[model samples]
Target chain A: MAIVAQTSRFSKIAWPVVAWIVGLIFFFPIFYMVMTSFKTDADAVNPEFLFSFTPTLENYANMTDNYDYWRFATNSIITSVFATLFALVVGVPCAYSMAFSPTRSTKDILMWMLSTKMLPAAAVLYPMTFLTKNVLGVFDTHFLVIVVLCLINLPIVVWMLFTYFKDIPKDIIEAGQMDGLNTWGEIKEILIPLAWGGIVSTALLTFIFCWNEAYWTVRLTTIDAATLSKLIEGNRAPEGLFFGRLSAVSTAAVGPIIVLGWFCQKQLVQGLTFGAVK
Target chain B: MANRTIPRILQTPAVILLLIWMLVPLSLTLFYSFIRYVLNSTVRPEWMTPSFSNWRGFGNYEFVLNSKDFWFAVKNSIFIVTSILTLTVVLGVLIAVLINRSFPGRGIVRVLLISPFFVMPAVNAVLWINMLLDPVLGLQGIAVNNINTLIGGLQDAPIVGWFFNMWPVFEPISFRATQTSSIAVIMMVTWQWTPFAVLIFMTSLQSEDQQQKEAAILDGASRWSQFRFLTLPHLGRPMAIVVMIQAIFHLSLYAEIEIVSRGNGNKNLPYLIGEFANNNIGAASATGIFAVILANIVAIFLLRMVGKTLME
Candidate 1:
């Protein structure tokens, strides 16, 4: 009794302080970036005004005039939305077949799909460029970004949906089939509703990945289809020239996704690590 | 149940898409690696076009193998990935344990910790390099310069003057330099990913057998011993998952390296491939093949570790 009481007392005082300190330390960089975004380029470089400055919305207000922020933001939305939708459309049927109808080769096919994710994007850079520009003539277009994003994320989407579908008992889906439902009807009426939470989380997670994707988005698109990743990449000032404007643009770029991430924090762990941890 | 047509039809779009996505570019890469191909050739214009007649089988591979930059990039890639994995796992375990128990601000702590993981890679690089790591204007510069000035002032204090004088002036490292840029990349990536590790481990920790832990406690297990025997084992699966997922992500890490170093002094395999792709199509393709091989070496271990569980 005494030992348990002593331990509880010790934990009560120690844990909260440690938790607060850790949280603040982790958040300091983002806080600093937001803080720096209010300072002029000159004040941003000066140590005297590090914490206190004449806070300005000039950077945020002038973002469109200075950097043309909306074009990239629109491109990001168009590509990420369509790409995620495409992945789900393709992934749903495949996951449905594998989940309901198990075979000896199902595991092998799943593993093979995952193996595609490991293929380095750099390995296919020149070939993709050649095909897009020289052959297909779709270079720097929203269609190309959408296609690339869909292909890259399809494996994870399939894996996620498979895991979600596997959790649903075979009886419910089997019963739906016996109730005079066709394949598409079974998916729409039975599977989709049962797995609504999983599907929503999967879509949200896929959107986040598509938005944060830097490599293909930056390399494949120059201006027309350039996403926020490209915007931030192109506007990376050498040193301290425009820290305020830079931070504002960056804040604008990642702000929505981070907020979206907060709402789906629970799903994030399961989605990202693919439930291997949980 | 043995109906093949419906299942095959269902999976066709996915399989065909991935097949083309994988095969088309890779086969082209193979062809380019064999032939003498260049985007430009002033003297021998024939070298500009990719053709079988211009076959230089294995020559590009040999050239890549012989190049010093290729080896450096390989070494640096391993160094950065290994370092980030090690740091994330270690720090992750500690933080996960720290926040595993109920606390007043646990929710807020989690939000703060996980924020870095969602920051776009490009923004992460820009924020770290320009705002935090810059020598003159970033936090490092501001902090170091302040410390130096304070020491300079204390140097005139009669008896303490001698002591302060003996201390040499401090210098802030320019992380953008050749040798240090890799370190910078490693630091920023570790910051972004450690939260991912912590989240996974924490989830796994929540599922740990509390009754078993209580039994150990009643059996007089010391704190260190309890951690070693109970907690560590519980975290094994999560650790493996963390390592494999991080391996896949960091193996092709590019935007951070590009934005931070631009291959000035620090180049990873992906960055090297990018550089080669700029003009030398043959060399880039060969290097791409090498990168593919390196990823496969890591992927084999990853598959063995997680593939079974994923199937289940």
Candidate 2:
């Protein structure tokens, strides 16, 4: 009994310490980046001033002059917001109908949508470039970025909305129908109010995805519609020369999305796994 | 009749959009793969445009298959995906279990852990390669130098001098090299994604049956046995979900590979495709088709698992 008691007591202190250590280790790089942002370029790479450097806002202040940070940031905001709105607009109705009155083929259709997500974007890279640049002449436009982002994220949005909608009892929708509400009225009045939480989270997750999207946003845009991802990729080979300013810009690019991510960590599992795990 | 028709109408726009999104570009790729095409070929200017007149049948596929880089990219892709999947799952399970219990600052711990998942892949790559892994100015270099300095000091001591003298000087690794670039990609991606796996596993853990665990304790089952039998089985479904979802995402890993080494020593199928697309449209299209085929094989199994859970 004493042996068991001693071991249990030892574990009680050890567990939390271990957990905190692991968490700090994982977070150290971001913490270091943020810390480095306050140093000058010289101090950033200097070994002597590794941790004791005088902090300055020069990196953040000179960001615009150095990188044209605002232009790219504005582009990121415009595309991600519109894409999220568009995906929800298309996704909600599809998920609503499928949830309320799923037919035999509903399952297959849902699976097919997900399968489309699995199609490697690299394979279609040339075709998309050719079509947009040559045929449609819409390359590097905000509209093109929005449409591509929306299309890529539409499947996840629908799947998330479907799972959320499935949780609401069908009796509510049926009652709305019996009240002489048409499909549109049922969705607008009843379903929307009930699944409001789910919709917001889905939109939030989709927005985060659009913001962090690196491939299409980077590949498709050159200057006009390029997001923060493009800006960072363009300056990728800094070779430690501009670590301070680079960290500042990179921090700016991902800071808001990381904060936003905290709120929807719960929804992320459902969003990414299609609610299969839960 | 009206009921089914309205539901179908609601679904039509989404279905049709996805269909067009999937088919048009892909069909173009398929068409291009069968033809002789190049963006710039002064010797064969006729081959520059995509047309049936430049039909090459299976020749492009043959070319991609015969290329040495194509095989290396395929092998490297498999190696990277599997390494990341293995590391994330192992580390994820341990961390999830570690924090699963109530502890001081648990909420803060979780937020910190998950922050990496939200970092843009480009930022993740740059931060790791230049700021953390650079052999000269990175933290790795600084830390290694400090340790070697410490060892040098210890070598002047009396009894510990012999031991310190035997210690080798620590040298920082350059992750930008061809051999280590893929490893860098795997490291950064694993750091970014372990949080995702941890979050899912922790959620699944919350739903585990406490009654079974208590009963196992009453039967004198050790901690390992209880976890192995009860918790491990409970985690099986979540584990599968993690593996499949990650496999799909990491198989097409691009920004990380590009930013890490610029495909210097590390090139995956997507990188290889991007390279080919620079000039050889036919070979690029053929490689793209192969990438699609690879993704589909993984997708089919994932879809089957997801379908089983659907409509339930």
Candidate 3:
């Protein structure tokens, strides 16, 4: 009995230490990037100043002169904001109907929506470019980026809303109906208020997805509508020359999203797995 | 009757929008795949325009099939996805179990661990390739140089000099090389995705039946046996979900491959298709179709699993 207790005591201390070590190791790159951003370009590469150097704000101050950081950042904000709002606008009602009034075919329809998401974006790259650039003449436009981002994220948005809506008991909606509320009134007055938290998280997750989206955003945009993703991709091979400024911009690009991600960590499993795991 | 009409009216816009989004570009891709189209062809200006007269039928598919890059991309795609899936699931299960119990600073650990998942893929790739993994000035190079210098200094010491002399000079690997680019991509993506798997598994772990575990302990079951019997079975569903979700995402990885080596040594299907789309429209479309077919194979199973839990 004493031996068992001793072993358990040993494990208790050993395991948490291991866990802390692992967490720090995983976070070291981001920590290093943030640390590097305060150094000058020369100090960033010089081994003599690797850990001990006079930190400066030059990288953040010169961010615009070096990379035109604000323009791409503004574009990222514009596209991701509009895309999240549009997805909520389109997704809310569809999820509302499916959750409340699901038909025999509703399950199949939901599955079909998810299946559309599975179709590789690479498969239609040229066609989308052809149609957008030639047929519609909207390539590299913010409108085009907004529409594409909205469409790519709509399925997940709807799926998340559906799962959230499913949890709100039918009696609440029925009671609202008995109050002589119209269909729109039931949704606006009853459903949205009851599901406000879910709706907000769904929007948050969708916005994060849009912000981090690299494939279509990079492919579809040039100078006019390029987001931070495109800006980073453009400077992919800096040849280690501008590590300080590059790290600063990169940190700026992802900093807010990482903070936002912490709040939605719980919702993420439901959002990404379509609630199948939980 | 009124009830049904209102719901249908509410759903029409979303349905139609998605239908158009899926069908239009895909059908265009299908049409282009059968024709010999090119962006700029001075010798055959007629072939530059996509029309039925330029129809190549299976010729484009045959051409893509015959290319060495297509096969390499397929093999590399499979290698990358499987490696990431394997590493993330294993690490995820272990980490989730580690932090599952109440710890002093568990919340901070989770936040730190999950931060990587939110880093944009472009930045993830660039941060890794240039700042973290670069052989000359990156952390890898610095660390390697420090170790070599330490060994050099220790070699001159009195008694332990012979042991230190036997150690060869440490060399930092250049991850941008043709042979190591894929490994670099796998490392970065695994870092980004393991947190995702951990979050999912931890959520599942919270719902695990503690009564069964206590019962096993009462039955004198060892820690290994208890984990094997109760926890592993409980985690099976989430593990499967993680694998399928990650498979769908990583199979079409583009930004990482592009930024890593610029498709120098690690071209996946999406990267290959991007290359073809530069001028060879027909081949690009055909390759795109192949990518769709591959994605669908995985999608079928995922949809099946998600569908089972839909109405429930």
Candidate 4:
């Protein structure tokens, strides 16, 4: 009894402390980046002022003049928002059909869509560039980035919507149909409200992905319509200085998404795991 | 069930979009692969433009197969993917278990733990390679230098002075080196993705049979045995899901590798393909086909598992 009591008491303290320490350790790098952002570039690399430097807003202040930060920031916002909207616009109807009225090949179609995602972007890199640059002439344009983002995320968007739509009872939709509602009406008036939470979270996750997408956005864009990902990748080799400005830009790039992510951590698991775990 | 037309119409747009997205570029790649295409060949400029006249059946494939770089890239891609998979899963399980129980500030802990997942890959690579893993300029360098200075000062102490003097000076390790570049990629990717694995495993943990766990406790099972026997078995499916999901992501990892060392000695298949595309379009296309095959091989298992999820 004493041993059990002692072990229980020990664990009661041990587990929480361990969890907190691990959490802090994991968060330290991000914290360091944010902290470094407030230092001047010179002080950023100086060990003498490591933890005691005078924090400044000089880096963020000169962001636009120094790196053309706003252009990239605007491009990121435009592409991500439009891509998320387009994906949902296309995905909802497809998921609705699969959920409410699955056909003989619905399962196959869903699997096939997921399979498309597994297609490596690199495999078609040359062709995509060739087609966009020479044939289609949409290279480095917002239209191209938006379309690419929507296409790549469309499968996951559809899958997420399908999973959410599956949870709604068919009887509800049938009743709505009996009440003289068409398919569009059913989706807008009935299905959406029922799955509003799922749809919003899906959009959030997709937007986050489009924002963080480094591969196509980098490869397709040179100067026009480049994103924050392109900004950081271009400036990857800072040559020992510019750490302050770099951190500021990175913080700006990821700050909104991380906060958004904190709100939807639960949905993230459900979406990424394909509702399999639950 | 009532009518197939509208449903098919609704799905048609999606189908057609993906079909074009998948087929058009890929077919172009396939066509280019069969031709002896190159961007700049002063000796044989006729090979510049892709044409039927330049058709070289099986030649590009044979060239790719014979290349030593191709084998190194395949080996490295597999190594990076497997290393990252093992690290994320093991660390995910441990961290998920650690924070499973209700505790003080669990919400904040969860926030901090999961923050890394939201970091952009570009930022993750830049932050790690420049600010954290840099041998002379990063935090690791500064910390290592601090320890050495501390040791140097300690050499004057009375009792431990001799021990301190005997201790060798420490040197900070550079991750940008040929051999260690992939290790940097692995570390940063694991940091970003362990949170993902943790989130999935935590969700899975929540759905575990509490009553069965209690029964094990009543039957006098140790914590380790209870975890080993009951929890591990329950987590089997989620582990597989984590492994395959990560495999899908890490197989084509680019920004991280590019930023880390420009694929110096740690070239993966995708990096190899990128290198070839700079001049040798035919070789690039052939390598892309190989990558597609490799991807499909990993993806088949995941498709089966996900399809079954819906069937249930």
Candidate 5:
């Protein structure tokens, strides 16, 4: 009894300290970025200013002159929002059908939809460039970016909503059926209210994915629809000369998305794992 | 009959959209892989455009197969993926188990931990390369210089002077070099993805059978044994899911590789393809096809597992 009590006493003090230390270590890079953003370019690399330096907002102030931060940011916001909306519009109905009234091939269709995601974007870049640039004539436009984002994210949207909707009792939907309600009415009233949290998480997560979607966003656009990802990658501190402004721009690009990510961290598992883990 | 038709009609839009999205470009890649094509050709300019008459049967594939970069890319891809898998899983399991129990500031801990996973890969690569890993100006450089200075000061002390004099000056490693660039990528990517693995494993840990764990404890199983025998087995499926998901995602890791070293010596399959796409359209398409085959092999196992459990 004494030994057990002593071990418990030891663990009570040790565990939280260890956990706090681990958390801080993981968060240090973000802290460093935010801290570096407050310095001038000269102070950014100076070892003497590592801990003690006059903090300045000059980096944030000169963001427009330096990188045209707002143009790319607005593009990112426009594309990500519209893409999320479009995906939800298409995904909700498909997932609803699969969940409430799954046929024999519903499972196969879901699997096949997921397989499309595994088709690498790099493999198809040339064809997409050729089609969009020459044939479609919509290259580097917001509409093209929105459509591409929506298509890539549709499968995960359907899969996440299906998992959420699967948990609702089938009898509830059938109860609406016995009441003579039409299909749209049943979904609007019975299905959606029960799965509202699921729907919101799916949207939020999708928006996050669209925001952080560096690959397609960077490759597809040139100037008009170039996102914050493109802006940051295009100006990667040539010779480490502009670390201060670069950090400011990067922090601005990802800060909102990171905070947004915190709210949907719980749903990331179902979304990324194809609802398989839970 | 009406209900069935409605569901089918509703699903048709999504299905058709995905079908077009998947088929159009892939077929183009497949077609181009067989033909002779280049974006710019000063000599034999007729071959510049993609056409059936210029089909070089398996010539592109042969060139890709024999190139030293292709083989290096294949080996480097395997190495990066395998190293990340090992690191994320091990670190993920440890961190997941550590925080599984209720503790102070758990919410804050989780919030801090998950922040890294959301950073844009472009930002991640740039941040690591410039602010964190640069030899002369990064935090790494500053820390090394500080340590050497401190050791130099110690070398002046009376008793520890001899001990400090024996210690060599610390030299910071430049991560943009050929040999160590891949290690830099592995570090940054592991930093980004370890949180993802933790999230999955933590979710799986919540569903772990508490009663089974208690029984093992009552049977006098030590902590290590209990975790090894019970927790590890219970997490098998989630671990597999994490591994496969990461495999699919990291196989196409381009932004990091592009920003960090520009494939200085750390070229993976995707980077290799990007390099080829500069002028050699045929070779790039063929390599893209090879990447597709590699991704599909992993995707098949994952889809099978997911399909089985999905219906259940």
Candidate 6:
């Protein structure tokens, strides 16, 4: 008993120290990014000022002049927000039907939706470009960006919403139906009310995904509909020269989404896994 | 079922939207793959436009297969994806078990741990390549410089002078170099995803049966035995889910690879496709078809595993 207790005590002390180390190691890059953001570009590269620098906000202040940060940010915000809303508008009804009234093909359909997500975006890049540029003539427009973002994310959005909607009791929706509520009334009044948490979390996760999405968002649009991704890519500042302003802008780009992500950490597991883990 | 008609009607919009979304670009890709398509061709100007007359059956497929870069990209893609998957799952399980028990500041620790996943891939690659792993101007350089400085200082000391003199100067690794850029991508991706693994495994851990665990304890089972017998089995489903979902996502990884090496020498399948799409639409289309086949193979396997549980 004494031996067991001794080992247990040792483990209790050791585990948290290990946990702290792991956490810090994982977070060090982001921490370093934020830290470097305060230094001048010269100081950012200077070895002596690596740890203890006289911090400044000059980079952040010049962000507008430097990167045209707001335009790209607004574009990201506009596209991501509208895209998330559109995905939800499309996803909810689809998911609700599949969850409540699953057909023999419903599972196959859901799996098929998921498989579309695995289609390498680059594989279809030329086709998308050719279509949008030549046939549709909507290249580099905000509408194109919004539609592309919404479509790219639609699969995950539907999958996540399906998983969430599955957890709701069928009796609740049925009871609403029993009360002579129309389908719209049943969805708006009962289903949405009950699945509000799921919908909100799905939206939050979808928004994070949309904001962080890089491949299509970067490739599909140029100047007219360029989001923050294009800004970061265009101004990547190779060779670590502009660590100060680069860090500032990178932080600016990912900061809000990361904070928003903090709120939806739990839901992230469900969203990422399509609720398989949960 | 009056309610059923309305529900099905409501679903029509989403279904139709996704159907078009999936079919249009894909059919175009299919069409282009079979045709001798090129964005620009001076000798044969008509070949520039996609038409049935331009069709060259299996020619593009042969072009991609014979290309050295395509094979290299396929191998590198598999290498990077497999390495990340293995690292994440192993680390994820260990860390999940380690932090599964109640501990002080566990919530805060989890929050801190999961921070990387939220970071944009572009920012993640930039942060790692510049700040953390830069050979000369980044933390790696600073740390190496500090160590060398410390060694130099010690070399002047009387007793430790001989020992310090014996030590060779350390060199910081340049991750941007050809062979190591994949390592950088793997490192950044692993860091970002281990938390995801931990999150899933931990969730599954919470559902682990305490009574069964206690029973094993009373039966004089060792901790390793108990974990092996009970906990590992419990984690099987989550592990599969993590691997399957990650396989799907990482198989198509692009931005990280693009941002890290700029498709220099470390090109994956998707990157290769992008490279060919510059002018050789035929080769790009064939590569796209191959990518689709690869994805379908994995998708069929994964969907089969989770299919039953998903429906129920």
- The C-alpha TM-scores of every prediction are 0.97, 0.98, 0.98, 0.98, 0.97, 0.96
Backbone clash tally for model 5?
A: 0
- Chain B TM-score by candidate, in order shown: 0.96, 0.98, 0.98, 0.97, 0.97, 0.96
Q: Fnat of the models, one by one?
A: 0.76, 0.81, 0.83, 0.76, 0.71, 0.70
Ordering by DockQ: 1, 3, 2, 4, 5, 6
Give the DockQ (2 decimals) of all models.
0.73, 0.71, 0.72, 0.71, 0.69, 0.66
In candidate 1, what are the lDDT values of residues A6-82, reduced to their tens digit? 37677789878988888788888888988887888788888899888899889899989888999889999999999
lDDT of 4 by residue, A1-278 (tens): 42344357778898899999999989988999999999999998999988999999999999998899999999999999999999999999999999989998999999999899999999999999999999999999999999999999999999889988998999999999999999999999999999999999999999999999999999999999899999999999997789999999889988899999999998888778777778
Q: Which 10 consecutive residues of model 5 chain A have the lowest summed lDDT?
A: A1-10
Give me the runs in candidate 1 sitting further than 4 Å from their true place: A1-3, A6-11, B157-162
Candidate 2 lDDT at B177 equals 90
lDDT of 1 at A21: 89
Clashing pairs in 4: none
Q: Residue B56 lDDT in model 3? A: 94
Q: Each candidate's iRMS in angstroms?
A: 1.6, 1.9, 1.8, 1.8, 1.8, 2.0
| A40-128 per-residue lDDT for model 2 (tens digits) | 99999999999998999999999999999999999999999999999999999999989988998999899999999999999999999
- Residue-wise lDDT of candidate 5 within B217-261, one digit each (tens)? 777788889889999999999999899999999999888888987
Model 1, B214: alpha-carbon shift in Å?
Answer: 0.6
lDDT of 1 at A57: 88
* Fnat value of model 3: 0.83
Cα-based lDDT at residue B33, candidate 1: 91
User: Mind giving the per-residue lDDT tens digits that candidate 6 earns over B1-312?
Assistant: 444576677678877887888888888898899999888899999989889999899999998999899999999999999999999999999989888876788888888888999998888888888888898998889899999999999999998799999999999998987789999999999999999999999999999898888777777888899889999999998988888888878888988888887846889998998989999998898899899888888888777776766876
Query: How many angstroms is residue B230 displaced in model 6 relative to the true structure, after the best TM-score fit?
Result: 2.2
Candidate 4, A20: how far from true, in Å? 0.5
DockQ of 6: 0.66
Cand. 2 Cα-lDDT: 0.94
